[model samples]
Target: MELDFILSKEEKGPSGKTELIYDLAIIGGGPAGMTAAVYAARKKINTLLISKDLGGQVLWTTEVENYMGYQYIEGRQLMDKFKEQVRHFPIDQEIGEEIEKLDKGEKFFSRNSDGEIS
Candidate 1:
């Protein structure tokens, strides 16, 4: 797993607008969301990860048995691993934020809890 590029926080054009364009936007920081981010990054896709927190339902479990490679691992520990893997990539993150609205047309846009549209 090797990537040849490191992306800036946002892509700016000659006019210097701070708007960011992503090839993919993943909502949630759970196992599924984190997994998607990893895959997207591996493909060199510009990605955005939005979530209120890192762990989801899996955080409530005391032990996980069916998660491959580990016979028995703590919920938090598993989530930590997922987080680590996700951080290894240059995926954009919006943790602790929630999407309020989403619009689709010529381009897709979303408004987060802070009222800032992206």
Candidate 2:
């Protein structure tokens, strides 16, 4: 998967905004999706991670300590760290965006509610 275009605010405003193309279009930004973004970006793939929320599943938890390196930390705190790490790369992250559809092509395409392509 590869991202071919990033819908600019101007483009989205005029096109009835729809569809996006990406090398890797991850639908969620939980630990899994964010982690994938980190790896995909490291490999130099055009990656886009669009999620309704940044920390999926894990955000609801009060505490988490079993993962690694940290003796104890809140779930939100850990997820924040994960997000920060992924941000170190050139991954295109779209938060608070809900994916209405995903069409796989030579490149993956995603459409959000605002008709903007990610």
**Model 2 Cα lDDT, one tens digit per residue, 62-113:** 9987678988889999999997898799887778878787677654556778
Error of 2 at 75 (Å): 0.5
lDDT of each: 0.78, 0.75
Which one wins on lDDT? 1
List candidate 2 stretches off by more than 4 Å. 1-20, 103-118
Which pairs of residues collide in model 1? Answer: none
The TM-scores of all predictions, comma-separated, are: 0.77, 0.70
Q: Number of clashing pairs, model 2?
A: 6
lDDT of 1 by residue, 44-107 (tens): 8888888889988889999999789999999999999999888899898888888777776455
- Candidate 1 has its poorest 10 consecutive residues by lDDT at 1-10
TM-score for candidate 2: 0.70
Model 1: lDDT of residue 62:
99
